[model samples]
Target: MRLSARLLLVCLPLFSLPGLAAPVADLYQVREPVASQQPEERDAALGRALETLIQRLTGKADAAQSPALAQLRKEPQQVVSKYGYEGDALLVEFDSISTERALRQADFALWGANRPAILAWWLNDGSEGSSLVGDGQSAAQVLRQAAQYRGLPLRLPLADLSEQLLATPENLLAGEPDALRSASERYAADAQLAVLARESDGQWQAEWRLWLGDEREQGKAQGANQAALADALLLAVSQRLAPRFVVTPGAATSLTLEIQGVDLKRYAELQRLLEPFAAQLSKVQGETLTFQVNASVEQLRAQLALAQLHEVTEQAPATESDAEAATDGEPGPRILPRTDVLRFRW
Candidate 1:
């Protein structure tokens, strides 16, 4: 099936979690060139390819050095669901469970497939001239390739008449939020990355800013070429956006989810959604459903954040008397300070 069609089908049953999306393409597959088709050479290449996959998933350059990951390297075939060759490249499909097991063992934060798309606005200043990097441009190609390697989704600005009037090389380089916001409003991207590159004294210096929701991070890098600059810029972007964390074994905690406005059908849907995360629905009284999950509160929240089914809002804690009075069919007081309280939208 087509990827888009497959994604749509998966989205229906899975709801908002990106992890349940289609697994085709290089999402979990890694390809490497082998010197020969010999079994030993292919085995060695698989090991190297697995390391590359681990690095891409964790957004850490040295993820393969972890003690837990050492086992996967020793037995690279353990994760291989299938393998084949296209010309000089050996294509390997990794079993999802095997890959997840290694990541879980290594305590790596898994970023689900439902990732935020970034709209990139690029401006380049070279000895030849200054120009805006448009779609399919050479400069844009560098960014696209870098994003693809890291599994990041990116879109370039249209630079239409309206965008041209608002956003220019000067404003983009100055990091004007207003100009950038105005030009980016049409794309409706989950995030915006503004990059300005200039060459001076034969060295390329680039400045980049990433805006995701309300968070913003910006940095500068100097490299000998555009490739080097692109690499550095993407590394910074991955570190900021990738959902990764250091897993602490045996540190899981339980949280009660007080979902408001849940009907029987919605509750059932909610149950199905939470079940994949190993969450047990312990109690369902009215609209509030309590779950016993074997994960840290932050991890649970992160997973939920990837879903589009709910919107998390902070509420003040109820007083002791208020909590007691909340029973008997009356709506309960909001749980304050704890982010465990979630409200499902739709």
Candidate 2:
């Protein structure tokens, strides 16, 4: 547990992870509310919990029904490392390596653990009255649990007077993110989600919008109550965000990445982000580092975006006229651009 691993050079002999700032600490663990601990009920809850785990990993709502998982579906207990009951909840932990290997063998694209954190600002309207859901409020607990079930790292605003003023019904359901974005600056979240829900005749319905970088995803969900509505909405969000980061196993390109401004915190964050890429530190030069990794270009960039790393675009080669002009003088050694090597700066 030494914090000083020489700028994480030792990296715990394959990067032993400390509890990180982002990335859910337990991606493979699921806590599903159970009706009872009876054999039949416990068995059913474990199946549902496995389904939730698969949905969280593949970002596909129907992944549990895949033919490749038929064996696991039949024998879900085979992958369950441990299970226990806590009050009315059933906690199940699945074997991570087995789950990922099974999914990868089935040609499923898997999202890494270093997922983005969503800052949610929600407003609730009931027949009696309306109120903004704050981080310290009891109502926020359901949202937190639902986010955990969906494997999303959710953040709630303090809901102070200023935030309460900003959480009007119109603003929460607005298509634009300007006001919410301005209010969310202090949170440093990777995405902004504004939701408005209303309960009528004991049924809950919700409308939500999510802004992740330049991409926008919006959806509507309904449930018998508030907690169901929260789960329904977060399932949609997880599915929408998964495609942006899922790395298919087809390509195993041996790529090199050069990152500048390597420090303690940055190294820790980089280790998590590059985990799926199978990254290895190759060399270090002052504040910069070079790593050899195996990953696809498209998905790699998407993962690095979570760290706010800027890609260094290589300059265009000189045109024919400029090339002829340069020929007049002694040409220096040409360094060819490498498509496999990506460059980024913090």
Candidate 3:
């Protein structure tokens, strides 16, 4: 079944959640050039920032052409929570709910903050010598800007005594897993990128390896400068990390879920929690809620996996007294079948 126009109402009541409850990073904000303080200039800057936000959200460079993007640009302030100047640049923070609405309307895939953080280990091979790129280094600046634009959270190795004892330029270039793991353990990054770069005949050449969970990908890029190489590497890395979604109209499905520990306050919190799913909460009877979502079962399941919400497991059958004890608030055993039934623990 297709999602109806009423799905637009899903954005309502989501902003009531306290600011302290927000994710660690504001993914919707972007920094753009501010040519002047004129109204038209500010509006143009807002439009550019919104475009960057859309690309970051959808993980597609052409997301500016999404149908709902025009409406978003027309009323940029609606999606804009605030804007201010940081030096000559204008930093614009977009309302997360409004941004999600535009993405849903455009039928784009969404990635939430629960994504894996990447620990980047980079070495620059220059005339002087091969050295690791640590925090506050020039190479780190380019990597950070590229990662931020693509909405990928990345960190460089500290290159302190511990890192020095564990990793070396030779080991990093050779893609030594033991050395990388030893150095990266303190950061606890879900993925790792190892890069060796050199400037050759006025061009930059980079050989890179990416490890995502247990999977690995390797490639090389040649660019005119460091910034160009950063862009190339980030594009490839972001594509691997971000989930992709296609617009499949008239393909929605409904699901019924039973959740424990959901009293009145928790009920409100649950609504706020599920806001990012963009599913319509069709009905709520006590602890169970029925939802009409715009994606297939597998898609919904994958999205939920990224959210890192309560764990879901196959429910075993409960005895008669088990049900009675649960009703009596004694925390009796419960089970959700592997199929349609979902039991969320608050």
Candidate 4:
């Protein structure tokens, strides 16, 4: 439906849950605006929707063209669970089981529903004036819609006077997360995205910087309007992030995670972060906590890194461990696990 909807972005003050990534609810649904209900236009929209879904699942924009998907392309409706029309939009829900099987058969890595939430600090400059897009701002709807299509969970700052001063075009263009790190801490997002867009001669050009964990990404895109720019930006972001967390079929193995500092609050947070891995509590020794997790080692590490948990030696438990325990003569060196193990410090 394209009746000029209200801003779908909501102001979400993050809970104190570190590494608790937001989950996308409708991962199998696709909604695209259509010009008309004509058969040809509907078919084209269906094709485009299929492509978007493939990219959302695989993080590869070109995944739909792969030979493995040739049959799906020929019969796009084969995996579709339902289809409907709402105003000027085409809503399609793909059969998740069938779609995931198809993706696995194609050897495409799958990005799970547990995705990182990105805090977006967007500024736009036009002939009228310059403004920062807040959660409730009109400019936010385009970004929100784009994020939905790309399966990205997005958060927008309040854009108060303080943020207006801090999220300047200069700082955004500098592409340093540290500049906004303090302001972003309250959002508790796993990733930070700063965007600076300017309109000239009826064309929009945007410069963006994304800070996710330790990695930094920078890119540029141009579009005829704000909606186009937003889609392009979110698509680019999805591509960049999907590879870090996507799970390959049959590539997962059991791992032992020994971490330090698991109080009640952290226990809940850690549990949520590791839920995707099927983490099981192995043992609790002093400040050290053990979790037996079934997941890809690399993906697990990457996921943990979002909470600022870094690889450390068993010399110290990760997170809330008493650093002075070693000097204070705690128990003898903790017995190390014989199987594969990863040690992290919070």
The TM-scores of all predictions, comma-separated, are: 0.69, 0.89, 0.64, 0.81
Best by lDDT: 2
Task: State each model's CA lDDT, in order.
Answer: 0.66, 0.85, 0.67, 0.82
- What is the C-alpha lDDT profile of model 4 across 1-346, one tens digit per residue? 1111011112112334545488887888999899999988888888888998999999999999999899998888988899889999999999988998898889987887778889999999988888889998888898898899899999999999999889888888774677899999898888899999999999999999998876899899889999899989889999999888977778889889987765554565776678778788777676567889988888998888766677875443433244456557774445444557888866
RMSD of each: 7.3, 4.1, 9.9, 9.5
Which residue pairs in candidate 3 collide? 315-335, 315-336
| Candidate 2: residue 24 Cα off by (Å) | 0.8
TM-score of candidate 1 on Cα atoms, chains taken together: 0.69
- Tens-place lDDT per residue, model 1, 102-168, is 7877787655444566788877789998666777566778777666656677788865566655555
lDDT of 3 by residue, 180-218 (tens): 876677776667888888888878888888876446777
lDDT of 2 at 32: 80
Lowest-sum lDDT 10-residue window in model 4: 1-10
Error of 4 at 228 (Å): 0.2
